[model samples]
Target: MNLWTVQTLVPLPVLVPLFAAGLALALHRHERAQRFISVAALSVAVAAAAGLVVAAHDGPVVNDLGGWAAPVGVNLVADPLAALMLLISSIMLLCVLLYSMAQGIADGDGRTVPAARGAEELRRTLQAQDADADESGRRDVLPVAIFHPTFLILAAGVADAFLAGDLFNLYVGFEILLAASYVLLTLGGTSERIRAGSVYVVVALLSSIVFLLAVGLVYAATGTVNMAQLAERLPDIDPGVRLGIQTMLLLAFGIKAAIFPLSAWLPDSYPTAPAPVTAVFAGLLTKVGVYAILRTQTMLFPHDEKLEAVLLVLALATMLVGILGAVAQDDVKRLLSFTLVSHIGYMIFGVALATEASTAAAIFYVVHHITVQTALFLVVGLIERRAGTTSLERLGGLATMAPGLAVLFFVPAMNLAGIPPLSGFLGKVGLLEAGVVDGSVLAWILVVGSVVTSLLTLYAVIRAWNKAFWQPCPDERSLPARAPIPLGMIGPTAALVAVGVSLTVLAGPLWKYAERAAVMVMDGSTYVEAVFPDGAPRGTGESNEVQDETEGSTP
Candidate 1:
């Protein structure tokens, strides 16, 4: 219960990986040393995030840095939503690490010889060096060295974003993650990856700049950048000033979230990264933007009708347009990337509704989507590895050769399509039910859009399944003998699929926690109170009314 104890515990999730990142970088020359440091750091972070979730199950836990009170010094706040996000992000980091290990092994085995002849000599030279390094007892370490430190740093940044209590600190955390992502996205420096990474970096930097401008405006207007303080003072601000700040912040976050029109960069950039990196990015980055939206809507401008409507329209457009893009894609990664964009609509719909049930549904969907989407992407990666390419034209008959991979892809694909008895279906049901209870035309539109999008997603998944798994392998006579899949690669993919299945099995408890998280987020007063024990109070206003209606209608 000591306040100082909280600070020590609070920063561990962020610090562990950061420390590991430094160690990994220093030991970059020794691959084994770097991998050990990276994995150890992530293991500790996962444990810490789990502990934080347990501690915050009942309420928020606030830690003031350097023993200074809020408004004067930084604070780290852990609410249920933040804890849940941290836990999911940590799980994703673990998967990415495993996948990286697997890919490294494959690449090291001379399996990754570039399709072009020009690179074949480079590959042979590298393989020769690898053999020499192995003779020197350093062979295993060379394949996946950069992955450890880069991924550890990425995890640290995500944890920082989840724990951040101030607007400026959140911005800083985002930049940290963004910088790490730039490296990961362009890691091999392939032409496709470099082009994609360039777009991603430029778009992300622009969004950060806009976010900084908004932060500056908020500070200038309110005299403080602490989220708790901003929440308290937001209601008292001039309507015009509040609107301007809200618009600027939303635009920045919207781009990051890939909401509707601002989403063009995502599909183009995400598909070019390595599979594990793509999976982690699919799971974590956009959610950070959604998290920002959730924070802004509930805490900063709770009762803005115009803003809510705009969000509603954007959600609809995003759902429709993204799925259409998914359906049109021929490559597995590109298809999944568009699907990722489409699902952002579901989260936006929940936020636009701004009711407890809808918010709870949003939280549930976020968790479920992260697991399901990451699993599917990894499965696609596995498919690419087994079949020699991710394009539908090159990938076929996987179901016969790799039944395990097929099952892994199918479960999440079904769940993502919102099929019955899955977490995705349950989440969509919750959103639709919330829409009905709200009794608004916008809510009804969202409900309809949800159903349509679900069906379209099913079509996209079925298309991929038919072309990649069910159909006969094209040029079967010319196909090379299938290479052995590394146990390390399969392990992480299996773990992610297991997590998705577990989500379906434990939907009840998970949904309950999600509801609690939604309530906590909607009622920002508790968060503010946790952060600033002596700060001026903030009103819950319409949020309380929405919560009451939701509770009254709950079965």
Candidate 2:
């Protein structure tokens, strides 16, 4: 694609939602209009992202925003990796939007679906007893008006981060999402949400402050904030200064990615949000942080052994500590939350390896985890909506009472636990294989940690399932008669589950794409070339990036 075309398509994913968010805010009184607007905007974004993905297979396509070229103006790049992320993100957004719209319709009025007349009374009684809980998710619920607009903005921010080629714009992307997330995280104004939102906001602000400082430092050091220029200049700077820059930048990104020691905020904050809110946040937000880490690690400091070693240790700790927390949790949402932290370790493992194959494995796992995690959370939301609690002690007989919900939950739950013949299993296997290829002691330790983590994940998930689904309910009130999850909700949730399966079915070709993306990411020159076509900086001599590409050719 030509630069003009690329410019139009590359920005559309971020721009379309931004414009639609305005419209959504304007049309706040008209629920149908806002819903239709959201669906249409995201549909257009998905098409744009899909096109970009197809185009990027040839090489990256770059756009100079505002018609100004590098170091002076913003740049948007649709490299293979960015394009792939954007495509999956768009798809996930649409599905979740569908699910949210369905949920709003159902819970907007507090009437029970065709149940025994007494069941309605019981619901009302339960509503009276748990007034705060009802208010938290059902009464005074987050309006579609605000939810749609903020969600659109959040989606745009994610897209921008993936496409951004400048640090300032990247910072802007993070802020855009962070602002929206603050609102989304505290949607119901419940005490738990307020508490969690406060923690989230505080953590987010610190990260942003550090991020801003890092950007200023980079500009001060290199005379530019453009990533390509930084790539060029960083090599010429003193090793100490470069390392300092890398340290600040990674520390900032690490908190955002929720890497261990920096991850204390995630499990506490995420579980309190409403289901759709939590699902999207879980699926996309930290991954954005991981994406930043992946970009800066490979692009700015290519292969710093010390940093890699540090990340390896962090990865191991994250895996063990996160899953152990999951095992200790009684709440499914919180269990999943800790698992979210744990799984990030897998991606970091790929990153620490700093090889094309390992990077490819990480990328593939990222996609798989995004789908499976979101789907599982959506299922969790369904459980809450149907059974009225996510506490395993309160939830049971779901297998017999809500068989469809059981199936929906089972598929993704197993996928997430890395059960055989599922995408999650395949993704983990790829990561493990890459670790084996590395054959270093640290790599072997991580591989072992990963396996143990997966087995524990399965055990935790199964334990929850057996308690929530297979076992008989402790009381009749735990489940109402014939409570059906609406088709609107089921369809969207099922769509994501289908996507999880697709990863397994298309694992071969997608793995190749990830390998190609890994090659591009490792070879910083490809990125620099795309951003600055006139002339781009090459790493001093032939680096591992070049060697990896050379070896990538051998196979």
Candidate 3:
């Protein structure tokens, strides 16, 4: 591509949604216009993401803002991994938009008659009362609405996070997304949602603070906040100082990723959001954490072998504990949220391995998990809508009533469980192969953990299927009548399922791209060069003094 075209490509993915969000806010009075703008923006973003991926096949695409060169101005670098993530985020956003549209249409239809009757009753009641207590007094009693322009703004924030070139910019992007999420999470202000969102907000804010501190320290130490420059300079930094900065960054991202010990907040917060919001969060947020961790480990501290054992142990623990949590949850959304935490361990396992093959596997797993996880959550949403509850006790005979939804749920559920001919299976196989190739005790532990987690995941999915679909509906006559599934809802659900199936069918090319992405990440020279054409000053590998001291003195 020409330079102008290359420059325009990176920004389009972010700008399209951002402009759409602005338009959506302006047109909020007209919900139809807002929906059209949101969908159109996401569609354009998806197309841009696909183009970026295709362009990245040849090499990385670096877009410098304001025509300034890297190391002087910010650069948006689109490597294969970044492109793949953008693609996954686009797909999930598209599905969420469709689902939300369906929900809005359904609510509008069902609420109109009741709303009119209620208004009439209120008018008559007011007419019999004092003239001073008029319609204005009751205007404040309007029902809370969920679907809004804020959701589109949230989408823009996520896109910005994926495409950001500098640490400070990433932080800004994260804050935007987090603020939007807080609103989305607590929408309608139900007691449970408020309680959950309060905890989520505190935890997320704490993590953001930690990240801010790391960014400040890194900039102070290295005189730059650009990730690519840091990668170039970090290796040459004082080992002690380097270790401390790296550890802080990792810790902050770990909290975000919900890695084992820090993961408690995710399960508590995620299931409380609206279905589309929950689906998007389950698919994108934690993975962003993983992306940060991947960047830190591979780019900034590649030679820090001291943390390898700790990462391995934590990965194992995370997997086991998360899967166990999944087993214990009776609610479909909560179960899936816990499972999301468990799967992050698998990604961390690959990062700890720090080999090209392992990283490739991690990349593959990330893509596969995003699609499967989001689709599963959407399916859970469908189940809740149809059955009027997501509790295992309340859901059943979906296979009989909604065969289409059953197929939609079953395919992704089985794939997530690592069934054959699916992308999940391919991902697990790739991870296992990487572990076996490494041939170390840690690798063996990871391999075993992968297998056990897969089995537990399988069990959890099967249990959900049995309780929610296979078994007879309890008190069938008493249960609510089955509602017709909206076309808007089915449209997105079908799109995501199709994407997952396509991933399975096209595993070869996709895996190759992932492998290439992994190789690119493992060898940081290309990325460094892309950011700093004339070669920036290198770090002295002694940046984090305290961490180095701890590592040096540790038994």
Candidate 4:
């Protein structure tokens, strides 16, 4: 019952950001205050999530909202998995915020204009966009005030999704994040961004509709939407009905996760956003979808061989197709977007295997990919600032001009390619080892596809590096005049790159923690008991530690 226990930390990740968003919005005229609030809020979230990661090692830490019990009241549950995700996501959010603030400073107050455009040109562009909007009956261009608040909302939504104790709450979290994302995706209100955001909004709406319909069907069929309750109830439902619900959930999450065939929207959508927005979206948004699938598959419907087989095949296709697309890309942002899609297949491969080792590998891969991919995107932003374009054909001699940028780009690039001893290599090795342990025909095929995908990913990034950094600039006059790179932007990006490498140095403990988290996920009883101990709803405002005390007192 102590106020300072880990349970107290559970909601801060969600609540702090939501509250900060309000403050940031209120103080939008004070850019300094807004930046401080955003950074401080996310910093607190990161610290709280770190605390949960340590405390949750013993078991789950639950906080029933308003003293209400599970299956009735909204609650937050921070097991090792959710805690780890929260920590990583908070870190990414914080780093990207710094990068964006720096970018805003360079672009005149909080505006996010292209570096190539002069002040007069940017003013004209905004005026033109506004004029076009008025004629078309569209919303006018948003001012700089909207960015921080919306970003905080995004952070809150991600936290809520990770800690959600029930399916409906998870759906709410998804909607919250998606709504913020649509705003962020269309930040500049440019015609290109509008086109990309339009496609993104349509696709996201479709996914939400399907997810909501599935939730309704699930409630109708099972009488409860709490994930712990569903875990117990799903096995008893008609197998056909269970499968139908399962397929629906997968379809919705698959589109969000950008699994092959469902992934066409990503490359086009992500590349059009501003760099910081793209970095966060690339790193965290799709991973949230992956987390949803992992949670439902392991807890609600474990060991369905048929479903696992299908996932494995899809994993293979996602890998091969994504990499092939990456190989064909000429733009740096689009290339990274494709590789992002391809690497997701590796995570899916691990999830399909569904063993402790495989699941653990999937968790590790998610963490590795989040840091490395985000760092890579941030570096690309730097490249664009330096060269005025992301076109591979036009970029060259960056290595000679900005050696620091070259290093920043190279470390993550090689890691993404799965070079030896890096976190990427370690994650891929873990997944491959799990596949070998599986030893089925489809598993072996996935193993081969993964290897080929890794190789192709290496080829794609290397080609990008050679062209962007090493090759000659075809038209030197087309390049922007070199301004000193802002330390604010470079600092956060370098910090992310270092964190990516740290994943390698700290692999031993991180991997073990992942294994423990995987065990908790695979064992539904652990989660169910944490939520409803002794087969009864918990008392109002009760924490998991209190439940343990009550259990001990029962004689």
**Best-fitting candidate, measured by lDDT?**
4
Ranking according to lDDT, highest score first: 4, 2, 1, 3
Model 1, span 280-361: residue lDDT tens: 8998899989988998888878868899999999999999999999999998888999999999999999999999999999
lDDT (Cα, 0-100) at 356 in candidate 4: 95
TM-score of 2: 0.90
Instruction: Kindly list the per-residue Cα lDDT of model 3 for residues 1-555, writing each as its tens digit.
Output: 675686588878777877887877766446677777888988898888998998877667888878887667767788888888998888788877778777657655221111111223323433433343447663222222224556777877877787777888788878988898888777655677799999998998999999999898888788788878887676666788887888888888898889989999999898877787788889888898899889778877885778877888889999999999999999888899999999999999989989998899899999898998999888777776677677887788889988998999999999998999789999889889988998989889889989999999999999999999888888966555444556777888888988888999999999899999988888878887777778865543355555678879999
Score candidate 4 by TM-score against the native.
0.92
To one decimal, what is the Cα RMSD in angstroms of model 1 from the true structure?
7.4
| Candidate 3's TM-score | 0.90
Q: Name every residue pair that clashes in candidate 4.
A: 67-540, 67-541
Better of 2 and 3 by lDDT: 2
Lowest-sum lDDT 10-residue window in model 3: 109-118
- Give candidate 4's root-mean-square deviation (CA, Å): 5.7
- Model 3: lDDT equals 0.80
- Per-residue lDDT tens digits for candidate 2, residues 316-410, read 99988999999999999999999999999999999999999899999999999899999999989888777767888878888987899899988
Tens digits of lDDT, candidate 4, 51-119: 999988978888998889888899899999999999999999999999988877876645544332223
Estimate TM-scores for all models.
0.91, 0.90, 0.90, 0.92
lDDT of each: 0.83, 0.86, 0.80, 0.90
Steric collisions counted per model = 0, 0, 24, 2
RMSD of each: 7.4, 7.4, 6.6, 5.7
